[model samples]
Target: MQNDLMGLDSVLSQISDVRQSVTDMNAISIAPNPLSNGAVGQVSFTDIISNAIRNVDSQGQEASQKMTAVDTGQSDDLVGAMIASQKASLSFTAMVQVRNSVMMAYDDVMKMPV
Candidate 1:
């Protein structure tokens, strides 16, 4: 029972971390960009989405490399590999959710009379 509680605590901690990460991402993406001429510019939506995709891809690649290292006996860090895999999976899932939300919003906008 104690082990189960510990595991649940760990899961909750990870969820909290993920939520914080998402909040940070939103804050960074929406934060004003300062130009060389001292003008504040808005970050483009495309740039934000592109950066997110790149980050997700990089995490996935890192996870794959970790798994491969473990598989080929190049490394003995099974726990680390598993953690990376989970992080990559979570990142991908979050990106998918964001994409779905954007699509739904677009559909709703299209359906509305302009």
Candidate 2:
């Protein structure tokens, strides 16, 4: 089981690397995202943050539903439930880390001699 998980992790890492490469190769624009509400230029910070918050919320909600199913004997897939739980935990942790970084940056900027 451990070996399988390790193999899965490696595959995921490789996939992410490939995705990054593809993104880099395709990133040819000084203009805002044309796909984003037909905007003429780059996506705004607010849009990025709102999307991230929505993603976190969706992950938590999904994990909660899976947990409820397992608890009520509605689902027999223990592994799936565990995976969902872990994903939710990781997402929340990442969200917290980002929040902390943002707060620290804000503090540093405020402390700058103006």
- TM-score against truth, every candidate: 0.66, 0.64
* Clashing pairs for predicted structure model 1, backbone only: none
lDDT of 2 by residue, 15-69 (tens): 9999988878633345555577655555567778899999989988998899899
Model number with the top lDDT = 1
On residues 51-114, what C-alpha lDDT tens digit does candidate 1 reach at each position? 9999999999999999999999999999999999999999999999999999999999999997
Q: Note the Cα lDDT for every prediction shown.
A: 0.91, 0.86
lDDT of 2: 0.86
| lDDT of model number 1 | 0.91
- What range of 10 consecutive residues in model 1 has the weakest lDDT sum? 26-35
